[model samples]
Target: MIQHKTLIIGYGSPIRGDDAIGPLAADALAAGPLPAGVNVISRHILTAELVEDILGADRVIFLDATVDGEPGEVRVRSLAPDASAMSTMAHFLDPRELLAWSQTLYQHEPEAYLVSAAGAFFEYSNYTLTPAAAAALEPMIERVRELIATN
Candidate 1:
């Protein structure tokens, strides 16, 4: 069995400016030695495999970027399986739906959290994160670390 008390999965496309923050933060966390009982994975936000990946973990935190809000504004929220605020995209299953499916299919309902950094640029380009978004990474990681440590 895959055993872990907490899991951090950072998902985003690295090529899309601020969208890269999640993966970048994931890399920073991965480079350091994590506390016991914690695990982290950095990847694009795809559904099929991610649902299976989260099964049985006690707590799961998914970090990503969102364009619907102010840039660099970090929003953290506990998400339920049926939350209406979630976005639905055919190419990507909503995170809440994935959690619900995991509970129904695998009998696991981990405490789910989403950490989203407001995104600015989504267009094609060789771009870097804006200064504000870059500044938020450390605090976000620190918060995740604290959550993992306490839970």
Candidate 2:
């Protein structure tokens, strides 16, 4: 079986302007030679498959864009493995809900966390992230690295 110590799931769409933040940051991290046991994947959407990807990982960090919060502000929340608390965003399977279901089905739940960057524009065909969002990327990446390293 493949094993990953840290898995970073970056979910977003580049065509939707600031929604691209997650993938962009993921790309930056991927361009580098990451620490041992680290893996990164970029996705245009978040799905139930993410639960499988996160399984057995020492730490799982989900990076995504959110618009219901302040622009450029980053929110780090430790989600409980409970379906009800999961935000039913645009995802087919809410992440927290998937985690809950996976725990019941597989008998294991990896340490999961979400780091969201607030987005300003999610317009169609706008392939550039907002200045504020772009500025937040480096810090976010560093924060994630630190979190994974310490845990």
Candidate 3:
């Protein structure tokens, strides 16, 4: 029973094979039976419009699919708003840049975390996760649940 406000943004493209992991994970979390106020969103990317939502939350978790590990590897790390990090493009923002924007523009700095899964493929495909990515879901879900529990 987490009383703190929490927001989870799952970003990735459904057509991009292993990238479908984020949205799928988001959907799973959204349907969970947890007793907490968890706002879940699935997006193709992050943008400035998300700042307001970030401002309203006590904590923010950004879930992204990456190529930084084995197909289903999961990494969760704390985030700080980097003073020098700024968006070169108005439309998209990585987690760090978005945190920096929230701190600088809105004068708010919610505790932030990035929970990412390594992706095996990014080519066009139907809404399907690669075998390794699929196997990764249970662990990812457990990790998310543990985060809320311990936070």
Steric clashes per prediction: 0, 0, 0
Q: Tens-digit lDDT track for model 3 on 21-123?
A: 8878888998878646778888888887888889888888888888998889998988898856666775788788888888889889988888888888899
TM per prediction: 0.86, 0.87, 0.91
- Please report the candidate that would top TM-score against the real structure: 3
lDDT of 1: 0.78
45-77 in candidate 1: lDDT tens per residue?
Answer: 746577777874788888888886777788788
Quality of model 2 by C-alpha lDDT: 0.80
Pairs of residues clashing in candidate 1: none
Residue-level lDDT of model 2, residues 1-151, one tens digit each, is 5444988888898899999988888888889878888889898877777778767576778888889677888878876577675565745656677678678788668788888889899999998989989887987788787776664
lDDT of 3 at 105: 91
Better of 2 and 3 by TM-score: 3
Cα lDDT for residue 49, model 3?
Answer: 89
